[model samples]
Target: MRFVETRWDGYGFFLDPSAYLAELPRLRGVLPPGAWAFVSEPGHYDIPRADRCVKDLELAGIHPATDKSGRLVLEFAPNRFKHESGLRISYTGVRHLSIDYEHSIDWMAVDTVLLDEILPDEDGGCVHEIALTDARITVRCRDLEAVWGGGC
Candidate 1:
């Protein structure tokens, strides 16, 4: 799929999915959990399809806490290898959510991060793929916003 560059006010540029995938190998050992698996596998990666797979694996359902009108936020803090600021992703009108953390909260440290938006489904809800250090967060919502320079 072809991805175009879009600008977000508080956030910087969005990475071109194709370009990011190509650069993955060179950035090995520093990739976030989901991305590590993508790079390790052969053949092309399908973002939307992967999102579906994750949702299926978790048997995801709309949480009672989910506000079809509420927002879901996820933050990734920079680690020693990456000196840049942190990242925060917010999804609006969240309809579905899932999180998998491979590390304890106290030891959390983010490395290379990747985010991809899935095609809208019949219900008009969208899904985002968040590949983070030792964690994988997936959400289906109506809108998404991302910002840098968070985490202390």
Candidate 2:
């Protein structure tokens, strides 16, 4: 499967459509009242700048407007993987809390697992760490294009 590298800032996860829909109620209970929710295909949109997209959605009356908290909770729309073939969800905000994996780690299992399996010296890539409320998540990947295959 072809997977694209993308960076998602804030709390994000991938879920099968039905599972995601079912989890909404519980998710709301934990998130701050004004927390934003986004559903999109991986690598299809810039997640960090999702506020702009959210504004567009709100203007179109597609979704309700939310406060400018700079933190968003995201889930992959159920059929996203079926359509895209490969899936990935980048995250930024859920730093300290123990992530609920049964609902969140359905599609991005490989990447999430890599967060723990890959080491800094294993690939000579940078290991990025995000301190969550209760734990620290580490991501070891080649940040530079040249490290993988890009320019001259």
Best by TM-score: 1
lDDT of 2 by residue, 1-152 (tens): 01222223356522122333344455443332222122222222333332212111110001111543222222222222222221222323322222322233334323221111111223333333322222234433332110101110
TM-score of each: 0.44, 0.19
The numbered model that scores best in lDDT is 1
In lDDT terms, how accurate is model 2?
Answer: 0.25
Deviating ranges (above 4 Å) for candidate 1? 1-69, 100-117, 132-135
**Tens digit of lDDT per residue, candidate 1, span 1-152?**
12312232343324346664565565454433333443334422443343211111211122233444576666555433433444445567777777766543344232334444344435555556654434555676766554445342
Error of 1 at 44 (Å): 18
Query: By summed lDDT, which 10 consecutive residues of candidate 2 come out lowest?
Result: 54-63
